[model samples]
Target chain A: MTETGEPEIDLLSHYARSLGIEVSGFEDGVPVLCVSGIDAIEGRPGHFHGGATSGLMETAAYALLRLALHERGEQAQLKPINITVQFLAAAKKEPLFAKARITKLGRRSANVTVEAWQEERDRPRASAVMNVMIARSEPEAT
Target chain B: MEKEAPHRDPANVFDPEKAAPFLFAGGHPGWLGLTYLGHGEDWTEIRLPWREELMGDDVRRVIASGPIFSMLDMGGGIAIWTRARRFVPIATLDMRVDYQRPAGERADVIARCECYRTTRSAAFVRGIAHDGDPDDPVATMAAVYMTIGDFNPAGAKND
Candidate 1:
């Protein structure tokens, strides 16, 4: 966990894990996320769904920002203010992977960049940028 | 290509089977589907069945903007889904849509999407839609996705 300042394990990552999003590893300012095809929350064919995809994008960005904050010993509610996604290709197989990077981290706001890819990195299936708002966690920690 | 009949019933309007490749279930209202028609590696065609519930009073006379956007979003999502994985939940982080023409009741919405490139974590995609001609696109979109979890078809509890 290394001493980043804030409490270890960003709350949002815990929620994402509860929802079944698996975190492979985080290093060099990059957070990696993966999900299998069979475990997809939505979709009818051997393809993924868009709304669900949007949810994933949000999750990845959220996780990256949280990790950055943890490293800085800062705690806050990370809410998405805006997001922009680009669908590059279809995810054909199972076990998709997503990587996230924080483009800019500010006191009240942050911007994150993430990409979803399957198999190889040469071609990405989708990519996104998310703008998030930082606020105090309600109720204060016990 | 088979011509899709305009559905009068909002509840039965979205066909999961027809829109199978692209449709995704689960949302506040629940039961949502989007379809893509015609196909090419770099380009494609799409269509979204009209439903009354997704329409607005002003757009009621025409197809609502939200549904149209949903269709484009779904179409673009499906375009990417076809390449990397099968039947996994994916979510959109953000989307931008350019509406060129107003969707009418009788006229069905259509689109074409392209996946240019992708990295380990994200994919980049682009698409366009039209009523009849590709030259006159009714809508256009660029989107991003986050891939998470396995299909777990039986929805079984892991040991």
Candidate 2:
């Protein structure tokens, strides 16, 4: 739980660890996550696949949402309502980076903006806006 | 007499023309085959083989936004993997998608993304999915990826 009174799920940490992402450095606001490369994730003739990038974007948004909720002293599970993104460029031979921030924070919903870049941050390869709905934290009926 | 057809490539590979058969299926009634076409420098493209199972409520119709979103999720994952320096299966923390227009009955869906920069703890990435039509789009999305280890692009081993 954070000072705001919300509990942290360590979403980024748990998720990245499961995927074998090796990352360093982190701040309370935003953090950088990493993953390794493999054949199952190849795109086109031989470049990096795009689907992978989309997954990263979606996951990042979730992580950010979790953080925000924790800061507000609220207990809630975040569900994405919608997301819009534009592919400005491509990434060839470097680890992709995602930068996320809250665009709108409401009682029932939250909006976030995320940018993905390859080697350079100035020239974003892709950008996205995610809309999320806050739901009561409940375990799925497994 | 019944003759059997030769074993060709799996329904899903990366053929743009054949992709329609897979992508156009919409949310028919069965599983479909798809793949990544690879995007720009750090992005990834997800391609699927058009299949009859994609038919939707309209019979001759394609899949629905729900299924399309599922495909996007897969595509997005591939995009992140493309940018990853090492071999790891990253998971989606959360994602949201907006449908600009219904997906056309042509070409495969290329979900391009890039995990360009990573801070000390969080990895940021963004991407888009296009079936070729730049003027219009089937859907657009953005998401964030979290890393487990120290992201090392220079330490990648391409298979």
CA lDDT of each prediction against the hidden true structure: 0.57, 0.52
Q: Tens-digit lDDT track for model 1 on A26-119?
A: 6565567776654334443456655445455567777677677777776576544555667677666377778878788887888788888888
Error of 2 at B83 (Å): 30
lDDT of 2 by residue, A24-80 (tens): 334565655444454333343233345445545655666677777776667775554
**Chain A TM-scores, candidates in order:** 0.81, 0.76
Q: Candidate 1: where are CA atoms >4 Å away?
A: A2-7, A11-15, A42-44, A136-142, B1-94, B97-159
Q: Model 1 reaches what TM-score against the true structure?
A: 0.48
Model 1's DockQ?
0.07
| Model 2: residues with Cα > 4 Å off, grouped in runs | A1-8, A13-24, A137-142, B1-96, B99-159
DockQ scores of all models, one per candidate: 0.07, 0.06
What does candidate 1's lDDT look like per residue over B44-132, in tens digits? 45566655444333213555444555566666655654543333345555577655556666566776777565444455777776777
What lDDT score is found at residue A91 in candidate 1?
A: 64
Candidate 1 achieves a global lDDT of 0.57
Global local distance difference test of model 2: 0.52
Chain A accuracy of model 1 expressed as TM-score: 0.81
